[model samples]
Target: MYLFKKAKESIVSSLHGDKSSPIIKINYICNCILKITLAICLWLSSLSFLALYLNADIINKSLFQLFSLSSLILSCLSFIILKRKNGTYILAKIKMYPFSFKDLVDVSLLTGVVTISVFDIILCYLYLLVAFAVFVIATCSIYECLDNPYMRDNENISSFSLSFISVLYMGLYVISNGVIFRNLPYNPLEYMGYIIKNIIEDIFSVTKKLTKLII
Candidate 1:
């Protein structure tokens, strides 16, 4: 009983702690919504992909459209909430607070677990895509938090490395998803060559477009 009371107090204190600022609260809420939406998308994508793979006629077009629309709406809502609540104007004034990248990772893991439990299947590829989306959002939030002039001096190499890796992972996951969506032949070793080739081509294409715009 004593331990339980102490634990309850700890929980309350943690929620009401100084780290629980308005911006942090908004970030958490937005992340939660995005995580839920990503889970739905993963489930729907998995179903569709499996149906396509097995030549099953179970693909319900109406249901797929509904899920896709909901996912898009929720994704937009998360973005709007973060922007309106922590717009550049307000973010500029905030000093460095205790931000936990680990918490974001934990949320991502929880999302994957819940998605699998609810869907009763493991769609590794789609799961990676969903996680990539989560990580991209997390990376953006970290960037915004670190954008404050106050944090500029305090930023460390480790945080920057993590952000860079998150972006890299997002890009790879997107490429993998594209490959799978196109129903390309995927032998791990062989498919990697294709993935790398496509990535290089995409980089050159983007660079060309940017150069044209600059000129």
Candidate 2:
């Protein structure tokens, strides 16, 4: 809730660009937490992408090694760009959309990496949930970025664009590679459209049962 409040404030501030306005200020402690978390996400991304590439032609190999390598390069670039505190200081400020991938958003995203890295068939099906999650996050992100004054700047857009593309790839790689269509129970790709919907319904069903039991 605090993060969302601050994110909302930052969005408003960007529209005004007023120094006095409360544009997403990252205090010492929160800033520290964000840096640490993003660093961990970046690290996991590196490792996961590397693992995927090495396992290319294996079950979990979703993306072409070339694409994985490109993602690695983008990660490295974003890392360096984000590390530079001066010009990139804007990142820590009006943070959302473009920078979301390189920022706090990756924490949730890393769960998909677990699915990709794990060899179990059951684990791979987690991709359905991950896909649903990515959709929600991406929709929220695009909503936040929409009509924001900060998005007008080409450089700022570039920063966000690069990070955004990498994240898109990450989300896509998660669903495409680690995911199986349950070919045995149905024809290939037959149930692909309903997979995520079914998974969500099943989750709600289980949660409802748990609630009833507790009651």
Name the best candidate (by TM-score): 2
- Root-mean-square deviation (CA) per prediction: 24.2, 22.4
The residue ranges of model 1 lying beyond 4 angstroms of the native Cα positions read 1-133, 150-155, 184-215
Tell me the TM-score of each prediction against the true structure.
0.24, 0.27
Error of 1 at 5 (Å): 59
- Estimate, for each residue in 1-215, the C-alpha lDDT of model 2 and write its tens digit: 54455455445555767443222333232234334434544554565565554554432133223334443443444454445443133333212111121122211122322111112222212322443443444444444455445666665543254236446645644443222222123343544434555556667878998999999
* Worst lDDT 10-window in candidate 2: 113-122
lDDT of 1 by residue, 92-205 (tens): 111111121111111112222211121111122233344555555545535643663443544343334333433443454465444333433345565566556656766787
Question: What is the TM-score of candidate 2?
Answer: 0.27
